[model samples]
Target chain A: MRAFRAQAAAELRLTARRGDAVLLNLAIPVGLLVFFSLVDVLPRPAHVAHAVTFLTPGILALAVMSTSMVSLGIATGFERQYGVLKRLGATPLGRPRLLAAKIASIAVIEIFQVIVLVAVAFAVGWNPSGPVWLAVPAVLLGTAAFAGLGLLMAGALRAEVTLAAANGLYLALLLLGGMIFPLSKLPGGMRDFARALPAGALSDALHGSLAAGGGVPGRAWVVLALWAVAAPVAAARLFRWE
Target chain B: MHRSDHPAISVSGLVVRYGDVVAVDGLDLHAEAGQVLGLLGRNGAGKTSTVEALEGYRRAAAGRLEVLGLDPQRPDDRTRLARRVGVMLQSGGVYPAMAPGEALRLFASYYDDPVAPSALLERLGLEDVARTPWRRLSGGEQQRLSLALALVGRPEVVFLDEPTAGVDPHGRVAIRAEVARLKAGGVCVVLTTHELEEAERLADRIVIIEKGSVVAAGTPAELTSEGGDAAARGGTGAGGGAGVAGVAGMRFGAPPGLDTAALAAVLGAAVEEIEPGQYRVADPGRPATVAALAGWLAERDLPLADLRTGRERLEEVFLRLTAGDRGGAREEEGR
Candidate 1:
């Protein structure tokens, strides 16, 4: 446990030191929420009075994806490339504990992201009528799913490839997952495709359980739960130390 | 730190394969606690693979490998075995952004009782770069920090891959001292390096491997001495003091294209300009031959460069063994 904490602290310091990752994971999500909320380019959400109400939930979900997947995966890929993972694997901490530490650090960064995004959302006239606490499970599940994918990508692919894939996927999910636009706006087939993705499920789950909607949709929760389990299992089975 | 009656590491018939490449083939290695076993080999001679297999980073295709009586190759035993072993990788095993101080502290946390990070920093001569990031540190500093990370856990056994490979003279001294300290503290140190001097200075016993198997292993004194019993018993009888040309020879570099025929006539011995700027006397065991060569060199005013004598016979022994290995390796590849 002591090893886990030390490793977690080390991983967090490395993650935080990366200027590009911070810009992608923390700044971009916050920037998107604030910029889109102030602009009228986005279609007014069906039931929500202001766009901030709709954007807030999806923005939080996006934050989870960026921190859990893009930031964590790219960093892990490079660390593995540089033989850091192999070195840690040789230690008494072992791979399982090292992995636990990495996820723990991701969770720590997610908390900071939440506090910042929520404070900004509140300042932009966003108030919730439905259960806001549901976002907790919603965010946690999203984090697990994305974090697993991140590790899977990092452990299985080359560092350069992971960098490109993580960034490319982040953009695709941002534009297609209803984080910036409504799922209803994506054409029929495209909307279904977007909804089938974990990013989409996370966006819907957060949107439904936040102030803009009442109660969580069964399908969104089920999709998230399936992904939350599948991605991590795949990552665990396929992850390599070197 | 735990006392064990048996050797710290024991291995026999170890086979490690990377697809078609047999990296460690039928290799045998053993080291008791408090012993420094120097593993010497040329590039691609399976030193790294052997170390990795023992360290539990690579699975042996076939063999019995025990570290502290635990088989590191077994998945179930890896972590348990890891608790008692420290490994220093060849390069870049640390986060580029992490400082030596932070890395040592992090690695120290893994053990129930770890050496203080500050103590390690001071010992490895890394105090000035304790706060510097790994990427920013000089190559020698990076190596010293890597060594410090391995020792921070106070492991009972340590595997250091080229610990002093690119280190400066001071860094090399620090590493050698720490290795000696580890030996005194009853820790087994298995070091693989191309630095022959390090092996000669630090290893109580040295094993030289080629094509995945040990060709010669004995104390440095035994291997380097021309009449040492190890040469008589060394595998394949390649150890017949056969260097450059078979038998005792004096080799030196002077001007290229020396008059070998005239020099041989003067010494009444076989002499040859083996390559550009390099000459060899077939039998330097005769002082008359030495005098004749010196006279000939004096007549030519040719300055000798790196003229080695008995001090470097381990290198002579190594050259003899690996010389045969190169031909065999090429034949195997050709086939």
Candidate 2:
């Protein structure tokens, strides 16, 4: 337990110190939230009354995925390459605790991301009507799903490959996974594929809970739950220490 | 059942294979508590593979291996033994963004009882750069920080791979002193190094591996003496007469074209002009032999430039052992 805390603290320090991590996980997400909310840019969906109202939930979802998946995955890949993972593997901290600490640090970072994005959204004249209680499960499940995928890529691929692949996936999911624009905006086949993706499911769940005022969507919950469980299990089974 | 009674490390018939190529082949080694076991080998001779297997970083292809009397590969043993063993890898175990103090503290937290991080840094001469990021530190500084991390855990058995490789001479002395301290504290150390002087100075026992097998194993004194004896007997082996020529001969400098036969008859040992104005007395340690040589030089008014008795150095022994078997294995495979 002591080792876990120390490892998590170290991970957080390292993440906070890196300029790129700040840009990707915290700055960019908040920047997107402010940019899209203030500008009349995105084509609002038929059911949505205000652009800020619709985009807020999606931006929050984007915050979760960016911090937990893209940034975490690339950083972990480099950690593995640099032998930090191997060093921890030889310690009493072990693999499981090392992973738990990484997850905990990601969750802590996500909390900060949530606070800043929500504060920014409120300032932009956004109002969320749905039971805000549902957002908790959506954010936690979304973080798990994305963090799992991130660790899987970090562990299985080379650092350079993981870096390129993570960036590519983040962009693809941002456009097609209903973060910036709704699934209705994507083409027919892409909408179906997007719904199956964890990114899309998370966005749908957050949007349903926050903007639409309907309880968390049942289908989004199921999709996200499946991803949350499967990705982490697969990552655990496949990860290589070195 | 006592931990102190068991060998700190024990390996029997250990084998490690990468694809079809066998790296460590039927190797056996042991290191006792408080002993510094120097593992010496040529490139690709399986030293790293053997150390990795023992450290639980690599799986053994075959045979038995135990660290601190427990199987290193077993999950339960891995967790239990981790606290008891510390490993310093060849490179890259620290995050580049982390400060040296932070990295040390993080690793120190892994053990129930650990050396203080600040003290370790100070001892390793890293106090000045305690807050410096790993990538920003010089290569020698990074190496010292790695060493500090390994020792912070207060491990019972430590495996250091090239611990002084890039360290400056001053840093090297500090590291050697720390290693000596570890030995005094009853920490078993197994180090692999290219520096023969380090091995001779620190190791209580030395093992030289060739082609995945130990070709020579003994104390520094014993190995050097063996090489000296071999040379004295005129045996033509690897490193044959290379540096060992000093072991069986008395080297002295004087005018060339001397009457060596007359000198040999008087000294009761063969005397030969080995180089221009240089002479070798076959056995010069005897008082009579030295007296006769000095008397002869004094009588001839020949000024003696230099004189010394022969004792083979460790390098001669290492080269003789490793060099002799290099081609023998390949030729056998070809045949």
The candidate that achieves the highest DockQ relative to the unseen native structure = 1
TM-score of chain A of each: 0.97, 0.96
lDDT of 2 by residue, B91-153 (tens): 879999988999989998888888999999889999899999999998889888888888888
Q: Give the lDDT of residue A223 in candidate 1.
A: 90
lDDT score for candidate 2 against the true structure: 0.83
Give per-residue lDDT, candidate 1, residue B63.
90
Model 2 chain B worst lDDT window (10 residues): B231-240
Segments in model 2 whose C-alpha atoms lie over 4 Å from true places: A213-217, B1-3, B226-309, B324-335
**TM-scores, all models, native as reference:** 0.91, 0.87
User: Which of the numbered candidates is closest to the native, going by highest TM-score?
Assistant: 1
Q: Pick the candidate with the highest lDDT.
A: 1
Q: What DockQ does model 2 achieve?
A: 0.69
TM-score of chain A of 2: 0.96
